[model samples]
Target: MTDAPRTLADAREWARVGTELVLGAVADIGDGEFDADSMLPGWTRKHLAAHVAANADALCNLVHWAATGEETPMYASAEERAAGIAKGPAMSAQELRAWLCASAVKLARGLDGLTAEQWRNKVVTAQGRTVPATELPWMRSREVCVHAADFGTGVSFSDLPAGFLTALVDEIAAKRGLTELPDGPLPEVAAWLAGRPHALADAPELGPWL
Candidate 1:
C-alpha cells in the first residue's frame, strides 16, 4: 500500500504540485468559457472557480485554528459556503482568476507560519472531524486536483500524480465503505469513486461523495 503523507513538508509539496495543475487549467480557459457548464451538475465554470478560491480561504481558517489553538471553523455556516459559491460567477474572469490565485497563496502563507507544534494542534474540518493541522494540506490538494478536472477543461484524472491517486482511492474507499471497484486505471477508479466522471466501464453506482 502507498503511504500517506506523514509530514507537513511532504503534504505541502504535494499541495504545491496540485495547485500548479489547477492554476494551469484555470489559466488556459477563455473568459467566455467561465459561464459554460462544468462537469459537476448545476455548476458553471465560474462556480467551480469560486468554490476553489473559497476553499483555500476555508482551509486557511483551519491553519489559524492550529496556530492559535483556538476554534476556527472552515465556514461560518452552510449558508455562507453556498453564498460564497454563488458569488464567484458574477465576477469578471480576471477578478475570479485573481481571487483563485490570491486565496491559494494566502493559504500557503498561513500554513508556512505554523511551527512543528502548531502543525500538531487539532482543528475541526468542514465535515466536523477533528484532525491535526497536517491534514489541511492534503485536504487542499484534493480540492485543487479534483475540481481542476471538474472545470471540464482538458485536465483529467490521468493528469494527476500516481501517488496522489493511490492515496485518494484509499481515502474515498475508507470513507464510503467501498470494498471493491471496477478494474481500470487507479486515477479513473479514484475519480469515479469521488462521484466525478471517468472512463471506467460498468463502475458501480455510488452515493454522493464529498
Candidate 2:
C-alpha cells in the first residue's frame, strides 16, 4: 500500500531537520566554493543557495495566504521567479548565507503561528497544484533536503530521515508513473528517485526533476 500522507506537525519536524542540514552544509562553504560547480549540471553552489533561499521567501507567501485569507501567490509571475534565481548569485557569499538563514527562520515562524483552522486553508503552489496549507511543511522539507544533497557536500539520501526518504521516493515515483516502491531500502530508492548515483546500476539516469 502507498504510504499515508504525512501530518502537518510531522512534516514540519522533517522540514526543521532538513533546514538545519542545509544550513550546516552552507556553513561549510569556503571561499571559491560558492562558484564551484554543484551536482546539478551547470549550476554552481551559489545557484543552489539562491534557489533554496528564494524558495523560502516564495513559500512564505502561501503561509501568509493561509494565515490571513490573503490571495498571496508564491511569486508575482513565473518570469519574476526566474529573474530572482538568475540574480541570486550576485550576492556576496556572506550576504547570501544570511538571506537564506533569515528567510528560513521567517518561514518557520509563519508556520508555527498558524492556527488549526489556518492550517486547513487552501493555497496553490507555484506549480499550480491546489493543496491545503498543511502541505507547506512537506513542500519546504523537500526543497531543503533535496538541495542539501545536490550541493555535493557530504549530505546524501542516506543522510536523510527514513520516513522522509521513503516519502520522497514515493512522490517522485508518482510523478514518473505513480509507481510503487522500487525494490530497495529507502535511501537507495531515494538516490534513484533523485536521479543521483546509487548502487542500482540498472537505474535510469533521469534528468533534473525540476
Candidate 3:
C-alpha cells in the first residue's frame, strides 16, 4: 500500500522536522565537504543539497496550486530542469547551500497560512502523477531528511525527530516490499544506510540516507 501522508497537519510537522535536520547538517558544511562525494553514486554533497532544495521548491508549487488555484510553475522548462539537476554534480559548496536556502524560503512562504481544504486539494505533478497538497510537505520532508544523512556529517536516523523515524520505518518497509512485521520487536533502525538487500527482511530496519 502507498504510505501517503494522512493529514495536512502531519505533513507540515514532517516538513518542519525535515527542515531542521537539513539546516543542522548545513550548519556544519565545510568548503571541501560540498565537493566530496555522497552515498548516491556520482553525486557530490553539493548536488544532493541542490536536489533537496529543488524538491522543496517543487513541493511549494504544488502547495500554491492547491491553495490559491494558481499554477506555480516549478521548473523553467522540462529541459532546463533536467539540465540543472544534471549540473548539480559540479556546483561549489557555497553555490549549493545558497540555492538550497533560497529555494526553501520560497517554499516556506508559499505554504504559509494555507487552510485545511487548500491542503487537501489535488494537483497533477510535473510527472503527470496526481497527488494531494499533503504530499508536497511529505516530499519536502523526505528530501531533506534522507539527503541530510547523505552528507556524512555524522548524523544518523536516531538523530531525527522520533515521529519521523517512526514513520520512516513504515515507509522503508513498504518500499522494500515487506508486508508483514518481523517476528520479533523491530530492530532499531540503522543510523545510516549501507547496502541494498534483495528482501526487505534481510535489510536493516533502517535503510541508509539517514
Candidate 4:
C-alpha cells in the first residue's frame, strides 16, 4: 500500500493535485459539460463552484488567524456562511467560476508565507471542532476532489492521489464501523468512494443509503 500523506508538504501537494484536476475540468466550461445538477441536492454546477470558492476563502481566513495568533473566525457569521452555500442559487455559472478563481488566489496567498511550525498549529472549524492546521490542506483536497466529481466532470476518487485513497479507505472503513476485513477479497476502496458498487454480491444488500 502507498504510504499515507503524513506531513504538511504531502497534504499540500495532494491538495494541489485536486486543484489542478478541478481547474482542468472547468477549463472549457462553455462546452456545457457542467449543465447537469451536482450530487449535492438542488445544486447545479454554479452552486458547486461557489461552495468550493467559499470553502477556500473560509480556510484562508482560518490560516490567517492561526498565523497571527488571533482568534480568526472561519465564517463571517453562521448565517452568512450557511447562506453563502444555501444561497448559491442566486449565482450565474460564469460568476461562480470567477469566484472560485478569486478564492483560489486568496487561499494560495494565505498558505504561501507560513513557517513549518505554523503548519502544525490548530484551528477551530466553523462547526466548532478543533483540528490541526496540517489537516486543513487534506480537508481542502477532499473538497476539491469530491466536489469536482459531484459536479459530474467525470473525475473520481481514483483520480485523486494514491496516498489520499489510502487515507480515505481508512476513513471510510472506520465510518462504516468495520473492524475486521471481510473474509473474502478486498474491494477497490477508491472506486467505491466514487459511488461504484463494491463487494455487492458477497453479502446482503446495503441498500442505496450506504
Candidate 5:
C-alpha cells in the first residue's frame, strides 16, 4: 500500500475493513468447517476465531489503561492468554461466532470513546515496548487483517488493501532491522513478514513477528 494508514482516522477505518473481511469469512463457515485446520499450524478455524475475539478483549484492557492512566496489561500472563484460547473448542459454534462479533464491536466502541489527549497517552504493549495509544488502532488493524487471511476460507494476502499491506510490511521490516522493504512485491513481502507462504524463495527464515 503506497499510502498505508498512518493517521488515526485511517487506522480506524482500515481496522474496520479488516474486521469486516474476517467476519465475512467467519459468517460463511459451515459448522463442520470450524474444526478444519487454519493456515496457522496446530490451530483450527475455531481456535483462530477465538483468538481474534480474545485479542479484542485484550486490546480493550490497553484502551482502559490509556483512558484512565491505570496500569492494565493486555494479558495477566501468557498462560492466562493460552487458557483463554483453550476455551474455544468447548464453545458451541453459535456461541463462538457471537463472541467474535461482540468483542470486535466492544473494542471499536471503546476506542471511539477516547479523546485526543487519551490517544496520546503512553502505554506498554504485550512485548513491553511503550508506545502512544495511537498504536493500538494499528495493532488491531494488523491483527484482523493477518488473521483474516490465516482462516484460509477465501480471504488472502492479495485480498488485503494495498496500503494496509504496505504498512504491515514496513512495520515488520523495521522489526527485522531492515531499513528498506524486503525484496519482493507488496503481497509477497507482507506474506513473508507475516510468517505465511510467499513466492520469495530467497527469503530468510524468520521467527514469529505476531
Candidate 6:
C-alpha cells in the first residue's frame, strides 16, 4: 500500500504546496473566466474558488473543535454548504482571490495554535466521519489539489505530486468500489477515477467523487 502522510508537519507542508498551486493557477484569471464553467459539471470557476475558501473556514472549525473540546460543525447544514458555494460567483475576481488566500492563512493559523495533545483530539468532518485533528491538513491538501484541477485552467493532474496521485487513486478506488482501473500513468488513472478527463480510452465510468 502507498504510504500516507505520516506526520502533521508533512501534511501541513503538502497542504501548503497544494494551496500555492491553486492560487497560482487562478492568479491571472479575469472575472469572466472565473465565472465560466469549470471542469466540474454545473460549477463555474467562481463556484470552485468559493468552495475552496469555504472549505478552509469549515476545516478551521474542526481545528477549533479539537483545540477547545467544543462541538463545532463544519457547516450549519447541507443547505448552508450549498448556499456558500452558490455565493462564490457573486464576488469580483480580486475579492474571490483575496477570500481564498485569507481563508487558507486563517486555517493555517488555527492549526498552528493547537497543542500536541489537541492534535489528537477528535473532530467530525463535514461528511460526519470522526477523525483526529491532524487529519485536517491531508483533507485540505486533497481539496486544493483536486479542485485546482477542476478549475480547468492550465493546472492538470500531471502537475500534482506523484505520491498524491497514487494515494488519491487508492482513496477514490476504495470509495467508489472500483477494483479494476484502466492501466496508464498514475496521474491519468487518478484523474479518470476522480471523474476528470484523461487520455486513457478505456477508463471506467465513475460517479461523483468527493
Q: Which one wins on lDDT?
A: 5
Cα misplacement distance, residue 186 of candidate 6 (Å): 0.6
The residue pairs that clash in candidate 4, if any, are none
lDDT of 2: 0.86
Best candidate (score: TM-score)? 2
Pairing residues by index, what is the TM-score of model 6?
0.94
Please identify model 2 stretches exceeding 4 Å from their true place: 178-182
| Model 5 deviation from native, Cα RMSD in Å | 2.0
Q: Residue 66, candidate 6: how far off, in angstroms? A: 0.5
Give the per-residue lDDT of model 4 (tens digit) for 1-210: 333546777778877887777776666466454556776566777667767888999999888877887888789798877777765657666666777788887787788778888877888988788987777887787778666666666675557777776666566656666554434323344445334445534543332221
Instruction: For each candidate, give its TM-score against the true structure.
Output: 0.94, 0.95, 0.77, 0.81, 0.92, 0.94
What's the number of clashes in each of the models? 0, 0, 1, 0, 2, 0
Q: Candidate 4: list runs displaced more than 4 Å.
A: 1-5, 31-35, 180-188, 191-210
In order, what lDDT does every prediction score? 0.85, 0.86, 0.67, 0.69, 0.87, 0.87
**Which of candidates 1 and 3 reaches a greater lDDT?**
1
What is candidate 6's local distance difference test score? Answer: 0.87
TM-score (C-alpha) between model 3 and the true structure: 0.77
Clashing pairs for model 2 are none
lDDT of 5 by residue, 1-210 (tens): 343447887788789999999899888888878988888898988888999999999999999999999999999999989988888888877888999999999999999999999999999988899999999989999999999988888788888887788788777877778765557778888988878888887788676666
lDDT per residue for candidate 1 within 65-166, as digits (tens), equals 898877889999999999999997789899999999999999999988999899889999988898988899989888888888888778988888777788
TM-score computed on alpha carbons, candidate 2: 0.95
Residue-wise lDDT of candidate 6 within 122-150, one digit each (tens)?
99998889999989998998999888888
Tally clashing residue pairs in candidate 2.
0
lDDT for each residue of candidate 2 in 68-149, tens digit (9 for 90 to 100)? 9999999999998887777767878898899889999999999999999999999999989999999999999999988888
Q: TM-score of predicted model 1?
A: 0.94
